[model samples]
Target: MIHSVGNACSSGEKRVRMPAVAGAFYPADADTLRETVVSFLSEASSAEADKEVQAVIVPHAGYVYSGSTASEAIKAIPSDAVYKRIFLLGPSHRAAFDGASVNNAFDSYATPLGQVKVDREVCEALKHADPVFTYVPEAHAREHCLEVQLPFLQVHLQHVPPIVPVIIGTQDLAKLRRIAQALQPYFTSDNLFVISSDFSHYPSYEDANRVDKATGEAIESGSLRKFLDALEKNARKGVPRLATSACGQSPIAVLLLLMEGRKDLQVRHLAYCNSGDAIYGDKDRVVGYHAFSIVKKAEADAFALTGEERAQLLQIARKSIDYELARKTDLPYDSTKMSPALQQHCGVFVTLHKGGKLRGCIGNLIGFLPLYRLVANMAKLAAFEDPRFYPVKESEMKDIDIEISVLSPLRKIQSIDEFQLGRHGIYIIKGEHRGTFLPQVAEETGWTKEEFLGHCARDKAGLAWNGWKDAELYVYEAIVFGEEK
Candidate 1:
């Protein structure tokens, strides 16, 4: 039976949810809670926060057991990005009901750090959108899954974003689907989703590691079918001793359903550990914890270079090629004349063409260094180091044309439909083999989309002709500029 609490209050009065597990799950004193969270965050390696993160999966366990794993996910939020609202989803451990519970009674959620306001407008809108969403105060009253995540949020996020705290009470897949469908419209770039879960509960340490590894792989694959299949397989292997593969399975399912066809979002595994590894835990029985983040693919135009910037890169490439042909050890360059944009890190390729034919080409797929430095290095390599052709001679310098391709960050695409022959370059990876083709390859060869993907898979990636169907495919756009044009 489900009950709604705090609805009888007056209009002007705000309902506040006082912490239920303050001293038990985490520190009760504000100073201690702050210090504990700070230590966990400080110990975590700062992951590169260059992408726009959309969602994250964190473990909900006692601070002593899973706080370090949770900190990895919270710290992944880019220090610059701010969200207007945070949708907190976690399965109900203490209550059971027919549908999801939205805490309409609470205006703010309180932790030792302070209170975070509830987005009342969003909560009201969700209640109206689906009959499955109810104002069930009891479902959230004693729930620890959602409450444990707040202290970490309070410490990591720049401005503590207002939250719409939800406790998922039903394991019905259809109901979960409907809930995902109802919330689909609100899944925007400015809103963040936090799914709280702990994987593989109460198994022998060895069995827990095996089961959790399979679960993690399925989640990282970004295929809902794979995740469900893996969950079932793991559950079968973990027999009488294992209670469940994941305590928060229902919440994780809802998140997978919500992200079904989103090509822009990519899942990254952040950290993993088990209770047995903790100082307080016994090695005989353990609970597994894993952290992951969903980040948006960086757009092509977000880092576009200005016209003047493009000219400078082209000039640098041309001069470097000429210097290499002249047998000089270094290219002539003036750093004092460089623009600020030249200092930005960017992946670049330098191509040498003569009479409209490809002579030599070389590049760096990942931009680890400054843009200007990459251009200078790749320019010499394209002219002198490309294995397909001999080094360009001084006599041929007058006939050569220099072209530059500046790439946007690569994004993993969900389906072949996401790729356009003339607009997007393709990158394919299967096992240890990898391959790439520029956007211009299609235009120059006049190949259809399928042909372009097939050649890249078979010839370039050394996989079967249809290997892309099962392989990981990434797409990016390039700003192609040449001296002739």
Candidate 2:
């Protein structure tokens, strides 16, 4: 049986929770802490900050080791957004107790940046909602997991909201689910959830890389069952000195439970690294860190081309390919006959196949030109400019298969479940390298979802076989049309 703990401090006196490791884990001085956090946020791409982020998974190791990786997720939150509360959850590293330990005894948590107020009302509500919630002062006295995240939140958010600090001490999934259920009403857009965790502790650099990649993929997959299966599998592999795949598995599991069945919410992998990569650490054995964000998709931002528009684009691609191979100077199309939809700008890809084998493929990811022009240009490029294949001769034009894929605007997804095999194509980007596979690739290769992602990560993006697990992954639906159709 679970029990509730914590003093109901309704008097509203600001009971302060002082920093436990201010100088050791991070800077002790206020200015230095602010400067260090600002530098880390600056390293992240500003474009990610524009997202409507709902939650983030960040590493909780000391600043010298995992700070940069944690910044990738923290910086992704738009500074201007307003939140009623922030739910900060982490696993207890110092104390062992049952269920969740809420720190309602403190009115505010103090760090170098400043003191952040605790949401006493929410804490009281949580206590009433579930028996698993209790005030365990010892559980948080020396815990570094939740403390490490406060400075980042203080610096990145334009307006700091009161936090519901939770220390997960129990590993029971049933109790965690009840806790999540209790919090579900408050898990709205007005609140943010931050799960603090570090991955693959005390393993060789290579082994950590391998194990962390699998763990990351499982988390991003958004299937709690899959994540647990992978976690158990990694534990059984017996990697030398590997303590755990993730330190905050329970907190993450709670988030996963909250996210299940919500198609609008998507998870994006922002950054990943191990302690071995840090200047102060060695490559022999290291701890791993990863950052990820859960964002909400705006339906209004996505655009879909009509059936007639798709047909016209297909015709344009086929005609362009035919003309290019014939050495003709002009494509055979009446510009006046094109509909308004064809005049719209959209990215397109033209693929050519001979005897059911890939002959050539080419396209642009950004929709800079009109649909017809983009398709025509890509068709010519696919036939002759593809470096992977020889230029198509006029004789082969009759036997060639032309296919056009009209794409929707690419939107970053939070989970692998967002990708529908044979329906939505995937795009992966990491640094300057990127790889894309059309929805049909899944159908042709008959690969499972994991295999499909593995191929794109390894073969196309030049990352490792499990690279997509940590790389930025986007999903887009395509309207595919073929000559036979």
Candidate 3:
């Protein structure tokens, strides 16, 4: 029969009985750890509520080494959740194990914050598979890989859920896959999957950034084979110094497999840095840490753009030239520059082209500026002030292809559920002012709608997203066109 492994806590006991890293790593005193954890959580950037997170990869080192990166991912987790369990998978740094070691102890793991019950049923299911798995307490004793994540979860989740912690110590890809496949039933929307890993080791800060970026690119591109190749190539560097990343390579493979069915599994890089960037720099030897999230897909037909609309935008660009030449004086391009009749109903597009290449493009989603006034104002700014591209030159004007996007009115939606990338341009309206643009805004640059919205939110709207909830939304059609100078 299954049973408790550690000493049971008495009614008079103030805390659960579990090992603490104490003075060796973070502050040993409970109050000190609490203050540090609370401070870190407070500094975290807020995440959007509409953004559904399915999986994440975080780093595991002392707070001084990788806490910031790990904290970013933890903060991004959906703040409101009631998942049945959390499956934390990490690589072993201390003892050796053949495949997976399920922590079968009955005692709850105590963190500086509180206790997380070990999910006995899930642990037993993974262990019952036979010779490939075992229940080992020794393997986890000195391992900080999984232990480091516990505090973050405690702080964010608030309500403690059962945990299935596995320390992977082998390079058996096949075994890892089989276990992952076997656990498929457990990875549902109601369950959260966490994979802990750190990037580059020993490479200079510059070299580490380059190396880690390659892995990040592969992860973002959703290429499992490429990720594996990166690891293998790093391993072949030499016998003494293997290029190991996210040490739990096998676990990552399984996560990728489970995430395959999802098309919108976006990889968000929350934070990245090598030991070199830390306050106390370590140029000679250092490990890299990164935090990332994967999101699920909610709709189909998300990224297609039509051609006729493309032509309409360019037409608007040409018209902008006249507006700019008319108002090139000291006055800024605000509402007062236009005639009374033209002030209230113009659709504007600020488009830029540099050295014959399309550059920065920004616009309104509705007819706030008159068609002519909007086109003219945006064209001038597009050419002269676009931050993405060098300013348009008098010499390059002949080669520049100016485009304008006159937008349709926005339709307020109840939720993100109504979003259509190629069809609906979204306007997120709140308070006195608002920001808007057509979905084609992203298509013009060939960026995915998700990528487009992220830039627009940060660059256009300047909204610090708490998550897409009941915010007012408007969708509009765009007539885009361009012409030769």
Candidate 4:
């Protein structure tokens, strides 16, 4: 039978869980720690999200190794953001136990930077609410994964809310599901969930890249079965020295369980690298790191771009491809001259047509970078990187026409009745099989609702024509503009 262990809190004395790997994993000095974290955040890519960030998946290795990647993930949370509480979860490398452990006994968690208050009440309630939660001091005694994340939170967030630290010691899916369900009430826009993990431990550089990419894609799919299958597949490949695909598999599974039915939550991959990418590291054996942001996007019609904004995007797209094809420097523009809508982040797709024929198309469903920058990147991809066609040549530039599609956050739909043919685009999902047709696709093809879904399932997602009938359906609207206009 399963059981719980350790008391929620002690009645006798004040308790503060102090740092364990302060001098090792990160700087122990207060000022140095502050400087290091600040540098990481500043040096991270400038692709800050203009969307609401609800959670993040970050690496837990030493600051020198994974700090840049971790900072990239944390940077997704807006600088002016405020939260009610933060739920911190990570796999415990130091202890082996039957269930997960919640930290209720400690009043605060101490790092070199400062002390962050522990949500003792919430922790106690979690312990009482589910047998899957307990207080195992050993689990966190020497754990550096979650502890290292505290400093990033302390330095980045203007108001670092109280945290409820959870350590997962079990690989059991049932137990992880229980933990996710217990924490479901706390997972909301008002709170932030930081999932601490690293990817592809002790694998060769090339193999680590392959394994980590597969694992990241599985996580982005938000399918528990797919994630488990990816892990099993990686193990079966027999990559030399590959100990694990993702060290925080249990915690990630818990997060995926929470995301099982939420369509508004878009998982965006931010950055990736291995220790081999670091300055003082070996390429033979490397540990990989990946950064992801789980955004709770606003409604599909939250805001729309104006005509001027749309025109500006078209100009940017044309220039992006021109610069790339001409082998010139990147397109440059003054940020002050741009509209607020252009600066806001939104998912965008770029389509290219040559002499009124389909040339190339590519896009990200949920983009975290600024609208202007995302459009430029996608435009280049459509012109040069779409795998379906050969790279575009300078001679083809004159005949190329560019079209941009800005998409809103995806929301789950009950039935085809909710999907308007010309106004709403449909995204179909069935297990690992998924595909999408932009809203304009309906207008372009004049396809019926069933035909639209059928084509998308078969041609795009590799599912049977009838596969979308029993699959999970989602609908999103897009703002489309083209150079022809």
- Clashes (N, CA, C under 3 Å) per candidate: 0, 5, 19, 0
Please estimate how well model 3 matches the true structure, expressed as its whole-model Cα lDDT.
0.63
**Predicted model with the maximum lDDT:** 4
Q: List the residue pairs that clash in candidate 2.
A: 5-134, 5-135, 6-135, 266-414, 267-414
The residue ranges of model 1 lying beyond 4 angstroms of the native Cα positions read 1-12, 238-240, 299-485
Over 4 Å off in model 3, which ranges? 1-17, 49-51, 129-131, 235-243, 300-485
lDDT of 2 by residue, 1-485 (tens): 10112122233555677778788888888889999999998987666474577899999999999999998988888887788789999998888888998887788887868789998877877887678999887888877888889999899888999999999988898887777766655555668999999999999999999999999999888778888998999999989999899989999998987765455677888899999999989888899999999988775344556776677777778888777766788765778888766765556789999988899999865544567888899899999999998999888887888988877756566689888888888888665457889888999999999999999999998999999998768887877887772
What range of 10 consecutive residues in model 1 has the weakest lDDT sum?
A: 1-10
Per-residue lDDT over 59-107 for candidate 4, one digit per residue giving the tens place of the 0 to 100 score: 9999989999999998888877888789999998988898999987799
Provide the overall lDDT of each model, using Cα atoms, as 2-decimal numbers. Answer: 0.82, 0.83, 0.63, 0.84
TM-score (all chains, Cα) for each model: 0.60, 0.60, 0.57, 0.60
Candidate 3 local lDDT, residue 119: 78
lDDT of 1 at 277: 89
lDDT, candidate 3, at 1: 16
- Compared with the true structure, what per-residue lDDT tens digits does model 3 show for residues 163-213? 888877667666765666545545555667889888887776766776777
Give residue 212's lDDT in candidate 1 (0 to 100). 91
Model 4 regions more than 4 Å off: 1-13, 300-485
